[model samples]
Target: MAETDVISIDAAQQLATAALIANRTAPDIAARVASALVASEAAGQPGHGLSRVPSYSAQAQSGKVDGFARPSLERVTGSLVRVDGAFGFAYPALDLALDALPEMARGNGIAMAAVRRSHHFGQGGLHCERLADQGLVALVFGNAPKSIAPWGAKEPLFGTNPIAFAAPVPGSASLVIDLAVSRVAKGKIMAAEKAGRPIPEGWALDRDGNPTTDAAAAMEGTMLPIGDAKGAALAMMVEVMAAALVGSSFGFEASGLFSGEGDPPNLGQTIIAIDPGLSSGGTYGERIAALMTAMAGAEGARLPGSRRIGARLKAEREGMEVPRLILDEVRKLAGGQSLSRLD
Candidate 1:
């Protein structure tokens, strides 16, 4: 393991608070946003951890991301809703969708929501897990700036385009699955680049269209999808649902969330919530729980959400481990000092 420096969650929150305050964001917004990031790290997703704080702070300060923006909702039908993120981070808008989904699902047996003009949301699975915890099954899809190449093509044409699903399970954490359609996430590439490490073979192609492990070159090139054509096809489906269906920017047309572009990324996300009871005649939870029990009873099969939930519990009890470089950067940013590390 790398030499990990552990810090209490409170310390992480304090650092996030200081950084956001230094950037002039409202205290409440700062705390909420910081808590999200901290929660991601505590849940073992370092790709969406403190590494993103500086970028978020910069985006807020530069007006690319509106710290005070609130989502506006429009009911398209009894079972469908549309949300405008108002050029803000995706969490708040997604929260709105979650709030509306239960009532809509109860009324209609299913609910669907589409959101546009949002920023990067760390993990779609988190949202689905929340719904699953509330006795609903959920599927979510999100699209971002183009970073992946289509099958047999060299240039980038689609974003990583993540999809997530969650279902309720008794006596265990919800069964949640979240993965990038690409072989790896762009954030993973960025992390490898920052650590001066080579990515694995098959994850990306070089600018010249040859496979490469060099993170910097891979960033300049394109990512291949998992399972070759199958994953690419899934990514295309996500693009259609999250971008085309929502009338939002698609692929390369979307603004880069991390590049500090003045324009909003014009991100799009789609969520589907289903009240299982409506389908299973009120025994939905018990049936789903029984299914999970049977699956877990199989040899060597662990629950879907076990790893992440375990990571979160461990972090809560033992604190989270952050990289030294990230810690130093956060300290510098929080202290109102510029650092050469990011440069």
Candidate 2:
């Protein structure tokens, strides 16, 4: 197993950005992606954290990822925008979307962003949370490489697509909802495999369609949906919004992200931002707070994303723990000899 150790947030981002730069990724793009990865790590999301560095480096070096690609934005008249990622990392494109969303939502009461030719969007909710901080409710959907099969199918068709939403609470932390339609994210299986651990049996099935606990076999198979048919349908809905509506490749047409092979995944993401005051006459925040207050009053009731918010806060104050082996690999990839971590 990889030895676990603590590393400061700054060190995590720095080494991650350095490794990407060493692999020929543009500095700005690398910084954006590295920041997102670090945020995921700090939020207690290991599946989308430093474990991605090695694969990203290999993809960048092998031309499976266009390290120097730039995202471009176009206004689709009023209230709508489209950002093309140029088949690079998704962070730059998502950043462009976030930058353009607030002003449009403020003026038009609603706005939508369509991002195409993108790579993986590390944490889907983080993007929506940005809009929430700007006083807008945001819904975000992203399509990834195929991993989950549709309901009643043995063959994989739809991606383990994710959808996230966030709403501002006026004074406190925003309410955020993020979920992968699959039983769990495919990256968690990948993480378990890397850490030499087995996954839970219900998470995925073997290639022959039997449920398995072996992470390796799970990776080669299909991920079960969260709510049987319901989750599968939701995954397809997001797939259409993110891929078909955005003119990106479908999940079945995309290449695998695990290996440096085929064309770039060319995924798609769609974001919707709505000004709550537009319809609620500025009382939306208080209305939602009432429901939250009632829910919190119930015995043993915990809100969604509470743990993630707390985890992020603690990581900010106490730093993050990453595997030492992962850090060594990152340093080696970056051609750096230092392996020091700050307290």
Candidate 3:
């Protein structure tokens, strides 16, 4: 087995900074992007963390992801809006959508925004949590390039298609549920491949349609859904709402994020925010607080989002620990000094 090395969060941040600089991303955008990646690591979602830096930088340098593209918004109604990401980083586009959500939800009791032509937005739960922080309930969904296969099929048909929900709990932490509908995300396959390790069986199939533990072969095949057909059905729903609903690419029609050529991936995301107080007659906050108290009061009962919140708090207080191999790759991609020198 290969050895694992851990490094502090500051080193991870510096590596991401170097990658962004090498990719020609602006300092402000680079910092925000780096923060998101590090936060993913802090939250224990390494698949979405700094491991993605090299690929992201390569995309930016190859012009597959424009570093300077700014998103433009089109407000359709008091509660409905659309944003064109203009091929920029999805983080900025999601930030713009969150910024507009409060006023829209306050005005109409609910707000929905469709994002088109965006890149990967990291953890969907983070987007929902941002709205929950403002005392609103949020649902977020996104569609990516094809990786998972439809039921009874051997070829890839849909992206992992993640969905997230968050609701404010008044005096306590927000309740958040975020998950990819597939058995696992494609990034995990990539991670396993990077580590030259075999993935668990049932995670994916080989090119010949046989279930395999080989990460590289699985990448050539298709990913399985979480609950057989159910997850695939949910993925289709998300694809319609996030991609078709937003007038963006869907399924195999979507550009490959790893191709590094052709048109941008043009991924799509949907965000919905609701002001519960408007419908609950001022009792929504109290109700949520009561439920949270009851759940926490129960023996061995932990609330949703608590784990990530606790992890984030610990990371904030004592700093995050990241895998040194990921850092080394980032440095090499950024043209910085090699890890051998530090060793």
Which candidate wins on lDDT?
2
Candidate 2 per-residue lDDT over residues 262-293, each given as its tens digit? 88999999999999998698889889889788
Model 1 quality (TM-score): 0.92
| Candidates sorted by lDDT, best first | 2, 3, 1
- Report the candidate with higher lDDT, 1 versus 2: 2
Candidate 1 stretches with Cα past 4 Å from truth are 1-3, 336-343
Q: Tell me the tens digit of each residue's lDDT in model 3 across 149-237.
A: 78877678889889999998876677898889888877777767766678999898888888899998987888889899999899899
Each prediction's RMSD to truth:
3.7, 2.4, 3.3
Candidate 3: RMSD over Cα atoms? 3.3
The residue pairs in collision within model 3 are none
Evaluated at residue 125, the lDDT of candidate 1 is 85
Instruction: State which candidate, 2 or 3, has the greater lDDT.
Output: 2
